[model samples]
Target: MDDSTLVASSKSGIEDRLSITAEFYTLNNVHANSAKYVLLFSSDPSSVIFFGLSPPPLINNNTLTLTSLALTTSFRFLGVWFSLSASSQFVLKQARSMVKDMAALLTLKKLLAQHVAYLYNAVLLSRLEFRLQTSLFFDSIVQSIIFPMFSIIKRKAGLASTTPLALLYLKIPFSIQHAFCRFLLGKKFLLILIFGNLPIMLFLIFKNLWVLRVVLLPST
Candidate 1:
């Protein structure tokens, strides 16, 4: 619980609970003076309303205190940016421009086709795959991201902009990439690990059974 999030319907509720938690931690010889929180009220702008004055400074038993949470329209957590406005055209616009630039520079060296293909996958596709798995993305966004990889292919092959999509990739020396399938397979591997571990499987069975019992219990 060193790094955690606190969510509440009002500013006072979060501050009150956090103070209590801080007290308990002080008794256990663990003190937290550094914590950051974002206040999100709505995905729609009109619904976002200020509830009260700024939260009081959070101080631990050591008398160390953190500054008040500042107003923010977006926040980055674990390398992903979430916008309060519910719109971000993905951060990889620059990643695409970067790959395109790298390809352009690599062309000057006249690298062999196989070498270019290797770099494209090892460097470019690998990053795209990592970003793909970070969160669930809309289909339209995925399609836009997918569309550029082929343009890179055509630029390298000296093909026309109107070159068929299949031919652009399938006919290339690298063969059509299965990155999306690979992303799906990565998720499937986690399921395999969860099922294979005996302790985890048993814990999951008991947890699920308890939940079902609670859910199916008659109302008072």
Candidate 2:
């Protein structure tokens, strides 16, 4: 089918699935009030064409009316900024704001190097590390913001820029740090697959293999 047809089919399938789930919950005496807060996000603008001329409202029990979530450039959810285009611009903006806040600490020159390092780790690094593994964030752009701050901290610690901050701070490089986080995330997901219910494990394995066959193998 054409791209437009596929998009329409996908949208219809989502609505059908939501209706089915709501019915299932109601029948089982389970209170599934997902319509109250569920947000329908379109990752691509072209997907809007799938909704037809007038998309139907998600009406539950002829009372709760759920409208299509308004298209937004970005929205914050659980402390992470998600953009419709999936760009790392939001993350970069947040990182810049954090750098500004952290830089203010540098004015306290009298603070010991270890103290400053502790503050940086506690205040700045903690924020940057949030949801690091799952998101396909622009690593280079983020590192550009981070490394300079690291250099500043290194200078405060009486270490030259050439001296690797990782050695002095007992931390890994930004790239390696992200790599480690990804590794941990993969392990966590793998554990879930292995120990989860048989149906779930089978479904996930099938999905992974399908992706590998359709995308990875063809690319290679």
Which structure among the candidates has the greatest lDDT? 1
Model 2 lowest lDDT segment of ten: 208-217
lDDT of 2 by residue, 98-200 (tens): 7766776575567656666666656566666663433444446556666656666677767778885457545532222332344355457545655777747
lDDT string, candidate 1, 99-170, tens digits: 567766675666555566667667766776665443445545554565655555566677798977667356
Q: Which stretches of candidate 2 lie over 4 Å from their true place?
A: 1-40, 43-72, 131-134, 137-142, 169-220
Looking at candidate 1, the ten consecutive residues that score lowest on lDDT are: 208-217
Q: Which pairs of residues collide in candidate 1?
A: none
Query: Residue 219 of candidate 1: its Cα lDDT?
Result: 25
Error of model 1, residue 215, in angstroms = 43
Off by over 4 Å in 1: 1-72, 83-88, 91-109, 137-140, 187-220
> lDDT, candidate 1, residue 70?
26
Q: Compute each candidate's TM-score over C-alphas.
A: 0.45, 0.46
